[model samples]
Target: MILGFGMDVVEIARMARILAGPPARAERFLARVFTPAERAYCDARQDRAGRYAARFAAKEAAVKALGAPAGVRWSELEVIRAEGAPSLTLAGAAAAAGARLGVARVFLTITHDAGVAAAAVILEGAQR
Candidate 1:
């Protein structure tokens, strides 16, 4: 069964600008949105722009997968990489919301082309 689904697109320039702003804002934003592992991966990557784009797409895709509205904060859904693939780790209200939505696991894919990055998320639930 399908629990939920989400997809998102982002402009590389926008994310780059956000990252370039006050360091505190970026830190706070990243703390809320990304898991430790995810943060580590991004931090270790030499392609900062690619890392930013991936995270941005993941956040957008997560909101869609959860079937939530725009107000859903980026911090609610975190994207991590495992074995070179993207995965999801939900926290706080995001977890509860996922449960309410009957989502058991979330799968995510992120890609970048030219100057744009995009992501797609799939939520899997118990087969009914």
Candidate 2:
């Protein structure tokens, strides 16, 4: 059965501006919103815009999938990769939503091309 769902899109140019303006801001934003592995992956990229746009889309998709605000204190939902496959980690409001929806796992996919980035998320619950 379906537990939750989310989708998002982001402009590559907007993400590029944010990354260019301040080094520390990017660091802070990444720390608050991304997992360690996600940060590492994004950091390793030469094209920061692509990474930032992908991350922005992922966060928005996670929130939408949760169907409720992720508590403010926790990092927003994060998307990472393992063995080149996508995975998820929820925090704060996102985590609460997952629990409320009886979700045991979240599945996500992301893509980007030209100046656009997009993502979709799906939450799967444990068998009843």
Candidate 3:
């Protein structure tokens, strides 16, 4: 069963500008909004802006699908890529929100093109 759904989009240029700002500011921004693993993943790519933008959008979409639960941190929603397949790993407040909502899993899809990144998330509830 579907518990909720959400979608979000981000501008690649905007993300690029933030990432290209002063070293300290950029690091602070990244550390505050993204996990170390997500930073590593995006930094390893040549198109870092696009990768970061997509992941950012994914996080936003996940939060929206989860009903914008209070006190949920950005790092709690992680976008992971293994063997070329992308997936989400929830932790901390994000996991708690899922449990509270009876969500068994969250499906995620992300794409980037034309200087924009987009993501969609679907919260699936456990069968009774």
CA lDDT of each prediction against the hidden true structure: 0.79, 0.77, 0.94
RMSD of 1: 2.2
Q: For all the candidates, what are their Cα RMSDs to the real structure?
A: 2.2, 2.2, 0.8
TM-score of each: 0.84, 0.84, 0.97
Which run of 10 residues does model 3 get worst, by summed lDDT? 81-90
What is the C-alpha lDDT profile of model 3 across 1-128, one tens digit per residue? 99989899999999999999998999998999999999999999999999999999999999999999999999999999888658988899999999999989889999999999999999999887
| Model 1 bad stretches (over 4 Å) | 69-73
Off by over 4 Å in 3: none
Order of all candidates by lDDT, from best down to worst? 3, 1, 2
Over 4 Å off, model 2: 70-76
Clashing pairs in 3: none
Model 1: how far is 40 from its true place, Å?
Answer: 2.2
Tell me the tens digit of each residue's lDDT in model 1 across 80-128.
6668787877876778888888888788889987889999989899888
